[model samples]
Target: MRTKFFIFIFTGIIFAGGLLLCSNIKTKEIQFEPRQEFSNEIKISKTFKVKPGYKLIVESDIADVSILSHQNDEVDVNFYASGSSKYLKDLKVDFEEGEGTLTIKVKRKREFKFFNFLSEWGIEKAELKILTPQNINAEVKTAGGDAHCEGLKGEISISCAGGDIKLKNHTGSARLSSAGGDIIANDINGELEAKSAGGDIIVRKLSGSIVAKSSGGDVKVELINAMGESEISTAGGDVIISAPSNLNAYVDLNATGGDIEIDFPLKLEKKNHDKLKGWIGDVKTGTKIKASSSGGDIEFRIRKGEI
Candidate 1:
């Protein structure tokens, strides 16, 4: 009993230490950003000298974030706020600039334990927008607001707790997720990993391998010319995948509470009411295509007018 009690005490001490380390124990010099884009919005904007190979990281506590590509070599950070500037006093903007990395963290100051609950009761609404060169890698995170990353030609990752996520025109591997909101991925040319905890996922014009999933909503994927090994699944909603009719692929689809539908002339290997295993073309030279659902239908079809 004594040993177990001591172990539990030690574990709790470590956990509490981690929590304190995450917030309220700060000691660093930082910077805040943006410039006004409209009359009713207060903005502070700044530009940083950066190279093409530098890594960019951003964390927005409760603000929506938009990342876009710029023509110049430097990076631009713009922050906009609505309502009184007095609440700005409770915001912390931290910047860490090194020779190879630039990290920007923006969040409300959590001075004490009750600071967040009290501050968010009537605080200013804000947003963060970033403009950087097209060749830099980036990781963006948001607490509960939407995140959009566009025209990035390098590895990009984004996550949101409870807002929508959009990735457009990216040329490198991308990772995207949302806790309770939808995801839209368009015009991507690389491998992708996208998921949603409780919302739908829609993908279009993808040219590489993909793994897209939804825990409690629908999933739809529309691909471009040349494909790769792909997996699309959902836990509680429908799944629809459309591709070129002549692509080389081995298809496998399953559904628990609904039917599985297909349009391609597949070489049927196995078929039943709740599952299907087949080949779209020569599987030896093709990729694997898999789709599943727990409580909805699964449809594998060719793109409209591609018949």
Candidate 2:
């Protein structure tokens, strides 16, 4: 009988220990729940009417801005605000329309609260999307997010302090600058000026003059047609150029601490391991293509079928 009693006591102790372990696990799970959850989000949108040939300006401090061209004559603007309840309430969007210009600005009201240190209050996010006619001039500025544009026939200018800038199928002149991100352009048909202080630059299918410079990243350009002067430089990365074999251009390549590679045939006016000055075809009719790198290699090559 005593042995049976001890056995029952042992079983009871085991069951109680298991239950206590499960209770502690549940408490830990509850403690971790707050850290895993993000604050609630709210979305807002607005549209504005804009005519062709009108100037469109977008200014935002922390949103990714995207501008796309359409055949429609009116412009549509969409804004998305995502954050805590207080953050959503503090967000504001303003629009102004003039005779020949439309402006959209995103602003956030300042607030000070002691409970803001709580982890439940997440970081805010703002996003803007603009659709305009195919012929409108655009100027977009963002302080902390990416900017993307496509299919516009007018001049497009973008400035970003902390995100990338991408331009595609732009037929008119374009000027872009990014202080903290990359710049990419494709299928551009006009004068191009692109600069980045902290990222790479990539250009493809360019048909006109291009001036691209990167203070801290690489540059890669593929010329579809050598129509005008091209200048590409990088302070801390490589420079690569691909052009047609029959391209008539005066080429100058310089690599300070790296190699210069030329895979195409050129009438060498001057040649060295780190620099080359030459012409691809007729010297007088040829355009000028200059590429320089301070800390990386420079390469010039002819496309496969072009040779």
Best by lDDT: 2
C-alpha RMSD of candidate 2:
7.9
Per-residue error for 13 in candidate 2, Å, reads: 38
How far out, in Å, is residue 292 in model 1? 0.6
Q: lDDT by residue for model 1 over 1-307, one digit each (tens)?
A: 9999999999999999998876655654455676443323457788899987789999987778999998999898998777544556667777889888999888877554644655443445778888999998899898857999999998888999989999999998999989999999989899999999999999988899899999999998987864678899999999998888778888889999999888888788899999999888776668898899999999888888321
Scanning candidate 1 in windows of ten residues, the lowest lDDT window is: 34-43
Global lDDT of model 1 = 0.85
Summarize candidate 2's per-residue lDDT along 198-259 as a digit string, tens digits.
99999988889899999999999888887778899999999989888888999889999999
Return the clash pairs for model 1, or none: 33-44, 34-44, 34-45, 34-79, 35-44, 35-45
Model 1 earns a TM-score of 0.82
